[model samples]
Target: MNMLDYIDWRGDLTFEQDGFNEVDNLVFSELAYTDMRDIVPEDGSRALTVAQVYGEYKAAGIDQSLMMNDPLPVLEKAAQSPRFKDITVKWYVDKIDTEQHLQFAAVTFIISDKLAYVAFRGTDNTIVGWREDFNISFLSETPGQTEAVAYVNRIAKLTDCKLIVGGHSKGGNFAVYACAFCDKDISEKRVIKIYTNDGPGFMNEVAESENYLSILSKTIKISPDSSPVGLFFLSKAERKVIKSDSKGFMQHNPYKWHVLGAEFESADARTDPFINMTISSWLNTMTDSNKKILVDYIFDSLEASGVTSFNELADNKWNSFNSIFKALTKIDPNDKTDIASSIKKLIASGKDVVISEKQKNAEIKKAEKNKVDNEKQE
Candidate 1:
């Protein structure tokens, strides 16, 4: 059973009867997708129930559909679910600062007693949203992440409940970051769990910090079997892979993930380690300066196509295609390598990484074989 199915079957169970689990975390994470700007409070003083949020959201006639992911159906069901219907929500923060290159939104869910789930909203289909995601590659600290820390710190002051910081996609990255970098007292005492669902990991500098590792014992890193996003940079937290009906990049969608009785169905397989290694090799090989140039080249071209979001770019694929390339020609060649040279380097790097990986695998197998033979002798 997926989230919607889980809601249908277990909707009647309240938090007291059935305490919050990983599945509920995913539910709350998706709840953040709903545009509850005015319907939800920002100061943590006022709050709204899930049912009320859905009512106001529907009454306001907000666009319920985006390019790929749509939360309307799940949200409607959540509003009706006993588990979520009356869940108190507050301190909604949604910001898209183009100047700062940040796209962040988050909300908190009060389940029962003194428990609160701080859910970070995943990336929406905005240009800046996707841009901020790529920006993480070159920049160590993003404006979005900094905001997450502040948001969590402020929210911590308002509530005494144990915080369960969680999110999907880039939001998951923020969840971990916020928990790690928030007030040390909160990170050590207040935070009960940190869930990052298919979220990318931090750079070496951030991931290796004492703060990040301080909460590593509480962090749960989940990914799909063929996950593309979850494998990037990776995390030291105990990682679990879930089965997904969808394949390839499409597995990033939460709905496609398979659910067991209450938990995600475990996968017997993992994605090609080679692909993840290749990506790691490529990024590690590229200088930070080059990464900036590549990112600017791609996004600047897309924006030049007279489109701000992927939805706008896809509405008329033919015209946007021509315009994006036209914008590329206007870029300074001294800043970016020629297409042929860049492609050649990409191919060469992949080959070298693959060969190196194979040699390492062979050595690992030989060592294992040697240990088995020694045991036989004993």
Candidate 2:
């Protein structure tokens, strides 16, 4: 039986399938918990419950039977296998079906996709702020991106058809990286287009390479109108701007991508304002040597801190400067220069650093109150 049949074939596991082929509802009968469905839940509060899985199926309305039955066990089997298994960056590969050529690579199965989906969990190997005592390391490399690049290359070597390279968030960035860095034959043969769906822009090290430039024409970056990811890594490359119904988290959802007649409203989106400002602030605020030192310190601190996932380390609140500082410190903690101190000094340099809508409103209100008071006195 297929993974789908194995997981949901029981009498109690009944659910109506939507016209979109998405599950409208999932009922877990007693007979549905087969051996193939067994999976060790992730530690802490990050674990996915059975009901949650069903809920995701209902919400996404996408096929996930193969992923559900095969992913976790396949990962377990692959790890225990003596061949093609390594503990580095926690690698696992599973086949969708023995008869089919489909496969999946996972980073602990936090999210599962029905089709080809790749994503990078940012801050995978870096600690930030108060997560030190939570038994999570903020230092370590996510070898998955490198492996994915290699995988794409291997797939290209086997096929000559146009390959649709795509990913969301960090995975989207990696898709671009792999397309750029892969062998020339692969680049020429099958890599027709790359869809970076709200992915982080490349780091400074790889931004200007010729390989990256080669695929610029084929690279299409799609992001929400006001994107948080774009605010970190700025790029002037190909951009497709989208509008989201909800702000922040809602914008990140693919479903929110505006679909017009034959195209979305992605023609005008460009680099993020925040990224430009940060890079500019860094350059204008400090000397070249200090910039070098600070950037290096941040990279090294993050590398040394070693975190496995962002869910373990991220704070409930969002502060741009603090977020960047945490990322840098996790990369290189040994650099003695204090990131917060430097940022504070830079902010004190008579710069317009604050972008506050509320503050602006308050100023307008105060001005109106003073005008009324002056009229009364007159």
Q: Each prediction's TM-score against the native? A: 0.86, 0.46
lDDT digits (tens) for residues 8-90 of candidate 2 = 22223222221111111010111011121223221223344334443333455443222112123223322332221221121
Misplaced by over 4 Å in model 1 are 272-278, 330-335, 338-378
* Stretches > 4 Å off in candidate 2: 1-144, 234-236, 248-250, 267-338, 341-378
Which lDDT tens digits does candidate 1 get at residues 184-293? 99999999999999998877788888989899999998889887777776478888889888765668889888888778989865766545555655466666777676
lDDT of 1 at 221: 89
Q: What does the lDDT read for residue 116 in candidate 1?
A: 94
lDDT scores in order: 0.79, 0.41
Query: Model 2, 236: alpha-carbon shift in Å?
Result: 4.2
